[model samples]
Target: MLSTKTLFARTVQTTARRALGTTTTRGKHTVPDLDYDYNELEPVISAKIMQLHHDKHHATYVANLNVAEEKLHEAQAKGDVAAQVALQPAINFNGGGHVNHTIFWKNLIGEKNGGGQLHDGVLKSAIENKYGSLDKLQQVVNGKTAGIFGSGWGWLTVNPSGQLDVVTTANQDMPSNIGHIPLLGVDAWEHAYYLDYNNVKADYFKNIWRVINWKDVARRYDEAMSKF
Candidate 1:
């Protein structure tokens, strides 16, 4: 019973209010809180490693990302193309670091929790269809992850054709950069294992499966599939 012009004005006002709320609430990114304590993933991943990785390393990335974005905003406002170009590497490195670590935290759990348990669902079915079985999929992913020459990540992602695939990226790079939606990823950086595994990256890769949260991976898979 309202005039179309009045309806349009009300909708615009509502949208503007939402946009303002988002802008105020999302002023900057911060390190996300983990669902479990640092000591929870012990024997496989030590409490010391978790503390350094999350509180120190991941925190550094979040801070750097905010600084880089602030610089980018200033450069853009000033129409400084050269400054913007110079900031690209920092933005990419810190941005990818932030995004990767955010996903990484949710991808782990204590054994008592859902870790190591691949539920019977679409995600498991897709893996079996592509790699024959969950064991084979892990073996393949682990093998490729070990083959990385340096710091990187190993990912299970949905490719352009909507099929599941295993992939790797070097040094803070991500599956998103290569046009895939990562369902789950393992950090291949030495910092993730050096204190506990001590130069045994292969063993780290082998043991990481024990703490993988496949339920979270399945949820990510379902969300990614819905888009297609």
Candidate 2:
């Protein structure tokens, strides 16, 4: 509901106490700060885009998610099954938004901090084995992600079989919905690239690789592999 441009600009960032990932405090959801400055991902991503994406779009989801949760709890207390069911879409969309963006933010790191480099590790080995090389892996992910018809995400996930896979989700849907553990995710939504790349989303898709946090990807890969 907090979609207005003026209101979104005011969405709190660092100052608010947010539970990273799915954790919440006092039954409330809040926005967290970026690990790097807004401009840090520049050339690949503009400061303006990062600011709007994080402070406005992601913050709105967090705010709306809290509202939806409060409503759902009230409905539960009243034994309103119908109301509870009706609230599913709102909760899923906003909750997924919060969850996805938390991962998305961690998935990026500025080049100054060694963003794009894929170090030798389990993740790299998996990518090489599955797709031949990192470049091939990016191509596979880009192709899969660009094919998303509307707002969605492209993911490099580790499946239950412990195989690396490229997958896409429509509109804030996370890899967990399909029982996959996401190692890397690319936001294919227009808002993610409209400012910098305009209509050539493919260019954005390719450029995002330059800022990808492969170290984080590796860490995620190790954790996911442990489960399977």
Cα deviation at 154, candidate 2, in Å, is: 0.1
lDDT for each residue of candidate 2 in 1-228, tens digit (9 for 90 to 100): 754532322222111112124443434777778999999999999999999999999999988888877886677567665666676677778877888898899999999899899998778888888899999999999998989898999999988788889899999887887778888889999989999999999899989999999999999988988897
- TM per candidate: 0.88, 0.89
Residue 199, model 2, lDDT: 94
**Candidate 2 segments exceeding 4 Å error:** 1-26
Superposition error at 121 for model 2 (Å): 1.3
Candidate 1: global Cα-lDDT?
0.82
Task: Quote the positional error of residue 15 for candidate 2 in Å.
Answer: 30
- lDDT (0-100) at residue 88 of candidate 2? 68
Model 1, 1-57: lDDT tens digits are 986645544443333223222231222778999989998888899999999999999
Q: At residue 132, what lDDT does model 1 achieve?
A: 96
